[model samples]
Target: MGLRTDPVIFSVSVALTVLFVGASIVFTAPVDALFGTMSAWIITNLGWFYILGVTTFLIFLVWICFSRYGRLRLGRDQDRPEYSRLTWFAMLFAAGIGTILMFWGVAEPISHFANPPQNNVEPQSVPAAQQAMGYTLYHFGLHTWTIFCLPALCFAYFVYRRGLPMRVSSIFHPFLGDRIHGPLGRAIDILAVLGTVFGVAVSLGLGTLQINSGLTALFGVEFSKPVQVLLIAVTTALATTSVALGLDRGIKRLSDLNIALAVGLLLFVLATGSTLYLVRGSIEMVGVYLNWLVPLAFWNDTFGDTGWQGDWTVFYWAWTITWAPFVGIFIARISRGRTIREFVLGVLGLPTAFTLVWFSVFGLSAFDIELNGPGGLVQTVVVEEDIPGALFAFLDNFPFASVVSAVSVLIVIIFFTTSADSAALVVDMLSSRTQEGTTPVRQRVFWAVTSGVVAATLITATGRSGLDALSEVVTVIGLPFFAMGFLMMVALLRSLNDDTVPEAVHHLPTLRVHLPRRRMPRIPRIPRPADGEPAPGSPRWIIPRPGGPGTERPGPERDHSE
Candidate 1:
């Protein structure tokens, strides 16, 4: 395989990334302060925009799913899904939010339970628990996936159907036309590359911390920067191997393993913990989430001025938006041959349902333990601020604690591997000139190593605070993409409307009336002599003309009676 790199996009993105990483290492305080201030301003001024923008994206995706465009496939009419449904869902889920779910499944809900967003709700009360579950579902549910769905749909439609290059700029083909090949397009792709690198780097950093915490819990390993950096190196090396193996052999297998392990872990928790309580709580949580989704989606803390929405809702929206490019492109790459409806519903529904259950299983179990059984989650998670350790602490209540904890650690590592490899692949696609065949293994390895370096550098430079600062940077970078999301919707809608219906879809059987066959009046046959002679006294033969029955034409006379 050729290198196939876009010189401008690759070089500029690499240089800027190196500069940012180097500056973060040298001027950590000032960079952090600047990002902190910018983050504060965004939350204060534009938090409403993030809320409304994400809500709009969700509405737009739903509308497109049910609209006339729903049947449009991401690829050609003859193309079918590249992977089985099970594997497809596994890859998307593993790449999209597997790491986030594992990291936050227990911590977010318990944090909310300990300190409810609203002042009216009492901490650790039933109301607080209900609100906690509702908010957690809101954060990880439809809105989160919708942010991913828009760009993925756009990229898939344009690249797979319209045959554009596989890059973020391809989404703008509807608006930019061939200008997508110019400097503007390069800039768009470069921005995507940067966002993806930092976004994945931040995730790697978070995963490293969680892994470190898990190690600390199990083997009493010291939770320090050196250990975390070493963890990043090891996981990054594994991710490099996966990406080098290419999509089907490397990423798909790892995603399958990740989901299997995750599901197994989830099942073990559900079977061992308060099964009945979790089931009932999960059902009730669904109800609560549905009832409050609208209000919660539109909630911007306008009147409350409590800043809770900024910290949780707006922050989550911005962070996920930053992830849209990496996750979106990766999703589009694997989502070929699927209908718009299947894409939207599957992307929006299944993972979300799984996330709710995952959260409920872990979250409710934590709640039950905190409320009825020996209570230590609140003290560990909320008071002590040991978010990463919360999962291990919660698992200690159940049997096979060490084994399950080890499984959880393995799950996190696999999740980290899948996410890093997927992001590296996507970053390579964004910066490259073409994605016709297998991507260059060296480029994928380079990105994988780059992501690890950034994560490790940030951790070593400023520790956990560096992760926080990087998150702020992501949110700030995500703002432009959030705005671009609106343009993408317009572009997608325009292209869909202008597109001709596929012949396969157009020829589908439809309701029609089959009337009884009408018998036509048969004209009397006249016999002619074999010698081409017109018999004497034979009238001119009349034949029916093009018009109905009455129209006739004169012909040579023939003898009917022999």
Candidate 2:
């Protein structure tokens, strides 16, 4: 379980990331322009794919839940879940979308409210307000979770269920068999690493922006490149130290702290701000989201102006897809031993519910202040382009403004650390040749530092266009993995169908159960081997008896050549 580094992947990933960061810093203007143009090209041409592919993934996951294979466990039938339900849920919520929610919960609604999504809706009107909250919830809702669900489910099924290595390429085993260990598989793992590194680094950079803004708002500190770099360096060092300490002692504790602070922040806003409005608005928004979900989910903006769609909806889908590798693998790694049904429902439902509530509290609070209270805050956000300050601006209107604002800053820092450390673990797994346990401390530390340095370098080099470059990089880089997402879903279904575990049979109403005197119980028969004996490593059929004391007892094993 010591450091078993895969030299090819580990070196190549680090070298490429360092080189890109160096080039971007040395050639700032050209690199910025290059990323901007490339991003535009991808969004303009293939934005539709990002939209439809994500929608398809959501639909595919739903089908899996209701299908016969839903009862299949991610691990062996006798194996119970590793982490308890509460810890598992908490960890997933924190690592999954905590940072994004911290970054955008306040700003996005205000941005949308100031400029409504549709052409006809008057900006800042009552309808605009409703739609703004609705759209915010929509963006962070089930759609985003589905992006994590598909890959997580696939990876879990392959690794825990089939006894394969915990690698993205393992998802192809149903299709490629042992070829999963070949060049194609290694290529897939490399792509996963690419997504993980870029996505995590960009997130680290973006979170730094929010933290920088928090400092400027609270302490009157001047925002500068040096300051931003310093923040990244400090936080990255903390994150790296946590990673070196390992998952149980480090990341889990950080995640728990994040969730606790997040809850405190949410409650303060709800109590200080409009409690009744936030509550009513949340209920109504949930209804509105459900009503509009189908149309919104499938809407690609083909007929009218596609600009807004590309900027907001399409960009969001791309961001989630880009982050899916890190988030998915992180979720999968922590979610071993849970049943498929439990995993799907918990991952998709709980986080989404939390997102909706959190967004409604913060987003609606800002909207209320804009509509009725002192209105300069929304203007500050819109006219001044001070998104990083939006949360602080909102907090300014509440009681104990300074205290809450400082707490918000702390929440952001913790969220940033949790996201970075979790991503480091995922990247370490993807790059390492080790079969199990956490990646070695050395590999984890290398990735952690590399991620932070890359982020700070890119931000320093590109200036205002730093985010645009990150966006485009993720959108473009996510395409190949996006395609793999679909294939992984297919492979999951195939593997589940052929699995030795019998599909759970729903017995139709029978007369035998009604008359018990002399009735022989109807035994559910198992399918026989297709030819002779079952293949080596394949599970043997186990016939289930009706009304038996031990219904799950194993039956005779059929030889493959029988």
Q: Could you tell me which 10 consecutive residues in candidate 1 have the lowest summed lDDT?
A: 528-537
Which regions of candidate 2 fall more than 4 Å away from where they truly are? 1-3, 500-562
For residue 4, give model 1's deviation from the true position in Å: 1.6
Off by over 4 Å in 1: 501-562
Work out how many backbone clashes candidate 1 has.
0
Instruction: Give per-residue CA lDDT, model 1, range 1-562, as digits (tens).
Output: 4677988999999999999999999999999999999999998899999999999999999999998899889899889998998999999999999999989988999999999998899999999999898899999999999999999999899999889998989989888889999999999999999889999999999999899999999999999999998999999999999999999999999999989999999999999988898888889888988987999888888788999888888899888888999999899999999999999999999999998889888999999999999999999999999998888998999999999999999999999999999999999988887765356789989999999999999998889899999999999999999999999999998889777666677668987999999999998676665564665557656555678795765789999999
lDDT of 2 by residue, 167-286 (tens): 888888988899877778777887788878888878887888888998998898888888999999988998998888888899888888889889888888888888998989888888
Q: What is the TM-score (0 to 1) of candidate 2?
A: 0.87
Error of 1 at 328 (Å): 0.6
